[model samples]
Target: MEEFEFITQSADETSILAKRLSEKLTRRDVVTLEGDLGAGKTTFTKALAAGLGIKRNVNSPTFTIIKEYTDGRLPLYHMDVYRLEDADEDLGFDEYFHGEGVSVIEWAHLIEDQLPNERLDIKINYINDSTRKIIITPYGSHYVDLCKELRDESISH
Candidate 1:
């Protein structure tokens, strides 16, 4: 469970990072995005969708709780758990976890307990108006390989 730091110079960079991460995605994967307001969670998710071959518009599912986008190669279960007030809100969390798609949750800190044990944790920290410090932590072998590939590219470039 080691963490790797990725610095993003712009929103586009964050999006590119998301796209690259999504390139290696398959079914039953959980990606938990953590950040403050305007930290680019939605931006990253949109990039992920684009990478997954989704042609639909991607937005913050804040009001809807869960947004499903199947236009992509695989199901993209975009979830925003910010609306949950109940600490024990299990509301359809299993649908993404136990389902056939990959789930990416925004404001996942709200429903930390509902997440799977082996997943990817992506955190975005705004360093300024246009800069972000992104950290990726892998909880299993899949993500560990992701981090390794990311690290290799980082080292090469």
Candidate 2:
């Protein structure tokens, strides 16, 4: 298993980390964000969206199962599975997950079986009242390369 870990003492730090990580993302990347509520997952994604040149506000798609934003370097297919567990919710997930755009899924564990086996997985855990721990796992050569790039950038800047 390929793993890279980072600890952020504050929400700002977590956002910064995500911004930096976004630089390595390209077309057709799948990023799975998994964590408890208030773990700063949305904060991190906001920074990532910023890095990708997305000007629209990135919010938790709790009500809407997925939100598509094209005003970025690449299209962003953002999904939140929090409210998608209902039997009536019909998610045409394949079109977005397999599309050419970059996909980021929040509460991804809910539909983990549908996700690509080789992708970037991010887990955010509350370290305490003022800290958060983020663990990033890369499952394939592409993500592994991205991890190395992120490591180099993290160390140098």
Candidate 3:
């Protein structure tokens, strides 16, 4: 698997990377976020939502599990699967995975079996109070191309 590594020196840099990623996303795209507590997963999601043209404030749906935002160019399905570690009940995840929106999942490993085979996996590591290391891995051809484009764009900037 190919991986892209990006080091963000500040929250603004992280947001910039998230927004750039969001620009390439389309409906049915799945992005998984993994990191420790307070690693800026929700902060990155908010920036992604903004890139999608969503005006509403995007927050982690920790209690609700899934939050849908439709004001964007494409609907945004934000999911937090951290609490589903023990539950075996199917939450009809296929519906959202195949839905007409981009799904961004936090703590996705908790429901790894329910996730689609093709998706982008992102791991964020806290480097300092304001710095972070983001690693992106693509699982399918579409995502591979997307990452390549993102890499090219980043290089040109």
Q: Regarding TM-score, does 1 or 3 come out ahead?
A: 3
lDDT of 2 by residue, 27-128 (tens): 879999998888887888889998899999999888887889899898888888887656344467767767878899998888877788888999999989
The candidate that achieves the highest TM-score relative to the unseen native structure: 3
lDDT of each: 0.89, 0.86, 0.94
Superposed by TM-score, candidate 2 places the C-alpha of residue 55 at a distance from the truth, in angstroms, of: 0.5
- TM-score of each predicted structure versus truth: 0.95, 0.92, 0.97
Better of 1 and 2 by TM-score: 1
Off by over 4 Å in 1: none
lDDT for each residue of candidate 3 in 1-157, tens digit (9 for 90 to 100):
9999888999999999999999999999999999999999999999999999999999999999999999999999999988875657799878999999999999998888888999999999999999999999999999999999988988888
Query: Candidate 2's error at 28, in angstroms?
Result: 0.8
Clashing residue pairs in candidate 1 are none
User: How does model 1 score by TM-score?
Assistant: 0.95
Better of 1 and 3 by lDDT: 3
User: What's the TM for model 2?
Assistant: 0.92
